[model samples]
Every structure is written in structure tokens, then in C-alpha cells.
Target: MAWRNALTKSMQELRIHLCQTSPASAGVRDFVMANYAEIKKVDPRFPVSLRECAGAEAKLTARYDFGVEKTVSVQGASSAAVLTQLQELIQLGEKMPKSGE
Candidate 1:
């Protein structure tokens, strides 16, 4: 329970930081986009967008790659689930193959 709360808090904080303004948002976007392929390799549907929102809030959007054109929220409960999986993978020293393999 404690770890769960911590994870939620972490995600919220990250989103907030990213959406603060300018350089931060740009850095976050670059990092996420560069690593997006690796992230998707983990779940094949990781939240792929980190965008600035109104009044210092950030939005994380996920697209349904399977023909559905609707956008989905990747924060809150969803972020916890996938991020946890990713952290686990990292701790276990898992490696995703390079693109074009």
C-alpha cells in the first residue's frame, strides 16, 4: 500500500514537473520520445505523449494502435501499472532488442 501511494505520487509529480513550462516540457518530450520505442517494447502500448496542459498541469496520452482513433489517459492508475512493470524490468536487467532486428 505504501509503495503504491509512493508510485502514484511520483507519477503525479513527474507530470506536474514536465508541464511546468518551456525547457522542462521540451526536455521531457525529447526524453520520452527518444525512449518511446523502448517503452513500447515493454508493453507495446506505453503512454506515448507528454504534453503541457492548462495552468501547470501535464497530460499523458496513449493511442490505441489497433485501429481505434480515440485517445486515452495514461496517468493515475494506468501510469502506476505500466511504470511498475517497467521498473521491474529494469531491475531485472532486461534488455530490449534494437530496432530493425
Candidate 2:
């Protein structure tokens, strides 16, 4: 896939923080169910961790090479909105120059 070429060379992991049972987390939960498989299919080796707290704010955190990290809040957004944000983030990461570039 073309997206594979754009994958950040330094991206290390992805962490999803959300409340297991909360209205604000509904969209993220839906997004996960709809896209999690596709995400891993994109890169099985990339670690994606899910941390559920009863009342935690929904957020997406991506850890990149050299400990660089990016995060975005997904609170109350619909699944499509969440997907859009994720795609935008990936595009942004791809545009960022790597070390020694």
C-alpha cells in the first residue's frame, strides 16, 4: 500500500487511552473495533497498546523514534472523525524528516 511508504521510519508504538464504559469513549471504542485490524495489517510489528480507565479521557498517543511522541484527544468524536484524525497524523509524521535527512 502507498501508505506503507509514508510510514514514519521512527514510529515506535501507539497507545490508546480511554474509558472502558463512558459516553466520551464510545467513538474511540467504535473506531478501534472498525480499524484495529486494518492498523495491524498495515504493520503487525508496530505495537498498539490499549489502556482503559473507568473515567479516563479518550486520547491517542503515538511514540516515535528518539522518544518523540504525538498525542491527540478524541473525546466525543465520531468514529469517522477519529479515523480522519489518525490519517492526518500519519500524513504529518511521514512529512517530518528523519535523523540525518
Candidate 3:
């Protein structure tokens, strides 16, 4: 029972973290995509794909084609608004009981 309690807590925490992180991460991704034109000007061959940016937490990968250039990677979290909403949703979810009691 103790182990079960711990497991449940852990799971809940994970869900909350994911819920909180996902939107912010997504926003970051969207920003990058929206600004791809500006970004590409810096590196014509920059890969501007959301999948490339999506990772465990929040990561971005840019492949530049500037003759002898290499892949550039950047990682960052989402903005405050996204984080706030996510946290709110997670808290709401936590308050609700699972189906079937």
C-alpha cells in the first residue's frame, strides 16, 4: 500500500510536469516556426520543423548549410503564459478522480 501510494504520487507528479511543460514547449516551437524566415536568413539551410525541435523536454535543432557549417542545437522552455495555463490544467486534473472510482 505504501508503495502504491508512492507510485501514484510519482505518476501524478509526472503528469503535472508534462501538462505544464508541453504547452510552453509547443509555444517555443511555434515561435521558432513562425520566425523561420528570419532564422533562415541567418542560415539558409536551417531545418525549420517542429518535430526537430520537439524532444524530451524542450530542444531545438537547426541544420545550417553555410559551407563547412554544422548542425546547431538550442534548447529552451516555453513562455510564462503557456506554463501558467498548463499548471492550471494539471491542478484541475489532479482534483478530479479517475473513472470508475
Locate the minimum summed-lDDT window of 10 residues in model 1.
8-17
> TM-score of every model?
0.31, 0.83, 0.29
lDDT of 2 at 64: 65
Q: Largest lDDT belongs to which candidate?
A: 2
> Where is model 2 more than 4 Å wrong at Cα?
1-10, 99-101
Q: What digit string (tens of lDDT, one per residue) describes model 3 on residues 1-101?
A: 13222223212222111122455456555544454466446445433344432234553222211221122222344444433443444344445554435
Question: lDDT of all predictions, in order shown?
Answer: 0.36, 0.78, 0.36
Using TM-score as the measure, the top candidate is 2
Decreasing TM-score order of the candidates: 2, 1, 3
- Stretches of model 3 off by over 4 angstroms after superposition: 1-21, 47-49, 52-56, 61-76, 79-101
Q: Which residue pairs collide, candidate 2? A: none
Q: Write the per-residue lDDT of candidate 2 for residues 2-93, one digit (tens) a residue.
A: 54334434456778899999999999999889877877887788788999999999998877666678999999988888777776667766
